[model samples]
Target: MQRSKVILNSPKIAIGSRADKYWSENGFLDYSKFIRPNLDLPKSLSYGSNPDLLRTKFGIAEIGFGNWVTNEDRFNYVNGLIISLYDLNKLMNIDYFLGLGLLSVSFGARGAGSALAHYESQTKIINVTRYHRGDESKLARFVATGGMGSFAHEYGHFLDYVGGEYVSPHPQVFALTGGRSVSRSRMPCNDRQRLRVITNDLLEKIIWKVPNKTPSAYYTRLAKFMMANGIESDYLIRRNELFARWFEAWVSLKLRSMNIQNKLLSQAKYSPLIYPTENEVREVDKIFQDFMKEFKSGYFIG
Candidate 1:
């Protein structure tokens, strides 16, 4: 009856599985592989929980939804939503969501795409289409429908907004825990330059400039794809988008959600670029791990 504990209590699809375990367990999903849709799965990801209630760090904006959908459907969306928020939160080690005080999501927003995030007053709102044709309203489908990176991408934009206006720390935001990531002698990302370093270092070093470099060949690949499709390369290859996408790939690595990686390919507009090849993912894994060892703490991400 309670959906809140599904993540902790169920073995269905553990959202927190590390990369190796998730792939080893075959948590990567493909709809074609699923002929029989289990309607009840979404039920477990439904009501009886609120992700904002789960934060051990600072505060998370309590989500408010538009009144155009059934409670079951709303809960389904939230259930899936929190799984992701929590996944990112584990790695945050800092209060990343401190800037925004409230968040609202819309189910029946007019002329809306599958999902989008924007600001209204001080609160941030994510607009997700309530129902689509043949609606895969189930938890996994609902989250992956827009693309795995969608939530992280939009949230990244929200972070840009929050961080842009936020010149300093919130009173409620406590100091960074676990003490430093060694090589992090640099300032506390005032320009909020955490992922930017990855942009210049990790991605730019290996992926962007290098030609046909597997795993890290994000820039070259995106350039080709954008050029071939006639879509402006700038659409996705922007500074802000880059920062957000780094978070997406980081999520892919952290949660080992192959579903996200596959969805990245499926969701072209979203940067599959950030989704590194396993070898590259493995490489970045070591790079970040080593970097953290040297990082002397601070909210690079938080």
Candidate 2:
């Protein structure tokens, strides 16, 4: 079968559809305003500004969802969530679902299974849950303090799916391991081709902007910190840790070429735009100093 043609700019939608019903239920009033009659694909041309992947046929649908409370209902609830989240209008099962929400499968903390992106092939869903349902106050605290970092981290995974590299620690990162729980699923031809075009380009630029340190090397450092602090699952580090450091490192470098840096900073509000704390800014400056030394000594290389 021929792949669906890529739509340049995402179209605005007319009301009255499953999306309307879902948005109305979820109270996503702001996002609801953008749904269109046909699939609103962001144009590939506009993606030229994006250094990473170009815009493709695959659509980005972010929904806030959760799972049932206990083990007995976990599987069923997750399945139901996939069904609820799937775009049913795609005439036949050609569409894929990439869920970015919460999962309360176990009785413990909220973000427990957030480390992995759950895939239910039967439903063509790729579930990526990061945050948990902590106390309202705690949730607010996370947002005010470090939620942006978390968002940017997981969002990077979605970018990876479209075409970006996983950039995370290799085997240590289980999301793409060859284990039963982690494997790549194929999308339809049209979706795959178009999505690849857009994502690959954007990701190329995103990755190019980063320093040459491998994720495993950085995670290894994180492991030492965990052991020093007597932490368990020290193997498990928050995704934002990498983003925070990367953001700082990148900004520090850009700070050198003022005009170029300003142009890039202007777009922060749109993509992974972050406002680091004063301390974060200071720390980034320190890293920048280290980066400069390495560059001068000719020991560090991109």
Candidate 3:
């Protein structure tokens, strides 16, 4: 099987602050280093920007920028973006298709240093303010590990887009979010719509079952902040967001359990933050394992 290629790009932009300067110098390089290894992608996966070589259908371009504009001079805060290759259904074989085929993951200098997922474009964005300006070594671990989780979550969306599903063997596990099955093709339009679809029973289950533990004060504070902002509810009730967040947490735990460097435990001091219980972890692990079996056999080729 041929490997998918990724092209990295950073456009020239004016740096407005010391933080932006830090990112301009080291963010993308460090991000590439941190994210690539943890993906556990098949060795066949590669990265490059050469149009001649990436003309193949399997190529993926990763365009990174510091900022994006909503209108004239109005900057929209974004961390990363993943534009689906299939969105260009008409021109799959053309260069225009290849351009949209790229996943645009950006790191914003502004905004709270948090990971975000966007459904419309199938993108994952992370704000890097904390990682670059704060404690570099410590925050790098947080950003890298947390970013990997976000990447996995967003990639889960990609999988759903490509005809894959995120499922568990037990049907009872899904009693809260409608049923045992959901698909990207059939997801609700937005998080608010999703809230209406989820059962109160499921919501209660999450309130009871999902633990609020974290490894460090930072994670604890972050969790509190997100909950206060209603982000946690969005993760719990929305089917797609729920699956992606689970994937994020499960992948983070797996990386830590494996004891790999700069994996999850790179922030060992903040270990166990925002983590699910051991039993819950095992359940999600099985789901991920099952998905990978199908994914490797069907979609991914070596």
> Each model's RMSD to truth, in Å?
11.2, 15.7, 12.6
lDDT of 3 by residue, 1-302 (tens): 11212221233222244544564465432233243243332222222222232234434444233343111111111111111222222112233232324443333332432543232233322222222334566435434433323444554444443322222122233222333243222323233322222222222233333333322333344457567766744343344454555555555566556543232212222234344455565644544565445434443331
lDDT for residue 274 in candidate 2, whole number 0-100: 25
lDDT of 1 by residue, 49-149 (tens): 34433332224444445554444454445444544453444455344343234444444342243344333324465454443335554545544543333
What C-alpha lDDT does candidate 3 achieve relative to the native structure? 0.35
Between candidates 2 and 3, name the one with more favorable lDDT.
3
The lDDT of model 2 is 0.28
Of the candidates shown, which would achieve the greatest TM-score relative to the real structure? 1
lDDT leader: 1
Q: Rank by TM-score, highest first.
A: 1, 3, 2
Please report the TM-score between candidate 2 and the true structure. Answer: 0.28
- Segments in model 1 whose C-alpha atoms lie over 4 Å from true places: 1-47, 51-58, 95-123, 135-149, 164-203, 210-216, 257-274, 286-302
TM of each candidate vs. truth: 0.54, 0.28, 0.42
